[model samples]
Target: MPMNLLHRMLCRSALWERTSATRIVPWALTGLDLGAAALEIGPGYGANVRTLASRTGALTGLEIDPGLAARLRDRHGADMTAVEGDGAAMPLPDSAFDAVVCFTMLHHVPSAAVQDAVFAEALRVLRPGGVFAGSDGLDSRGFRLLHVGDTCVPVPPDTAAERLTRAGFTDVDIETGTTSFRFRARRPAA
Candidate 1:
C-alpha cells in the first residue's frame, strides 16, 4: 500500500519524533562511525534522515514512495539524496554504503521471505565492517491495531539478532522495549 495521509501524520507527530530521536537513532548509531557513508531503507517520511545526516559524512534514503522521495529530495536536498526504490530488491550497487538502516517498515513487507531478503540486501550493501541497524514496533496489540492490515509479518526483537546473523552479519544486538525494539549488527571485517 501507498503512504496515506494518516501514515504521514503519524510519522511526523511529536511522539514519532521523540521515539526516533531518543530510542531509535541512538540504538541504530550505536557502533557506526559518524564519518562513514550510510543509507536508510524504507524511510517512510525520512523521519530518521536528520539525525543520520547530522552524523554520517554522506547519507541517502531509499523510499518506496516516489512522491515522498521527491519531497525528501527537496526537504533535505543539501544533506542527502532520496531515491524511489524497493527494499527487498534495491537497484543500488553492492558494498556501496558503510551502513544501512531501516525503521519500522520491515513488517510492511509483503511476506517474511521479503523481510529476510531486505536483511540480506542490507548486509550486501554494507562495506566490510559496516553496520546494518534499525528499529521496529513490537507485535503488540496496539501496534497491530495501528498498522491494521498493513503489517505483513512483524519480526519480534527476540528473533532479530539471529536473522541478522543468518544474513552474514556479526556482533548482533537487539534491545526490546515494551512496544518496540532496536537492533544493530555488523558485517564481518575483511
Candidate 2:
C-alpha cells in the first residue's frame, strides 16, 4: 500500500507511537494473551511493535515493503524478526504462532477480497486456540483526508464478524469507536 508523504510522516511521528502505546495497542489487544510466539501482519513504522514486543515472548513482523522490512530488521532485529512479505500470502509456516495481528493496515490491501485473503492467511499460520486481533481506522473525513493518494478501502465493522467466521475463526468480536474499530477472534482448538 502506498502512503502519501503526510500519511507517512504522521505514522512515523512520536505522537503515533505514544497513541499506539497508550491507547490503540491496549484497546486492540485487551483481555488477550499473545503467548510465546506472535506474528504481526503489517508493522508499519514499528509504531505498535515496541508494545507488542514487550507483551509476547517473541515477535515477528511481516512487512509488505522490502525497504520497511529491512529497516525494521535493522532497527529491531535484536528484539523482533522482520521479514519482507505480504499479509495475504505470508511466507511463514502454518500453525506456527500463538497469535497473529495487524494494526490499521487492512484497508491498504487494495480490495475486500485481498483483505479476506489476509484473514485466511492469519488463521492458517496461527496455532489452534491462537488469537487474531487488530484495529483499523473506520471511514471518516479525517481518515479519508489522511489517505488522499493512498490505497484505502475501509473495512465495514458490521460485516467483520461474518468475514472472520468465513475465514474459519470462532468467537469473533468487533468493537467500533468514533474513528476506528477493533476486532478479535480465535482459531478453534478442535
Highest TM-score, which number?
2
Candidate 2 steric clashes: 0
Clashes within 3 Å, all models in order: 0, 0
Q: Name the lDDT of candidate 1.
A: 0.80
Model 1 root mean square deviation, Cα atoms: 1.8
Go through the candidates in order and give the C-alpha RMSD of each one to the true structure: 1.8, 0.7
What is the per-residue lDDT of model 1 for residues 22-101, given as tens digits with 9 covering 90 to 100? 77788756766744788989876667777888888899898887887888898888888888898888889998998888
Model 1: CA > 4 A from native:
3-5
Stretches of candidate 2 above 4 Å error?
none
The TM-score values for the models, in the order shown, are 0.91, 0.98
Best by lDDT: 2
Evaluate all candidate structures by whole-model CA lDDT and list the values in order: 0.80, 0.93
On residues 1-190, what C-alpha lDDT tens digit does candidate 2 reach at each position? 8999999998889999999899998999998999999999889888887899999999999999998998898888887899899999999999999999988999899999999999999999999999999999999888899899999999999999999999999999999998899999999995
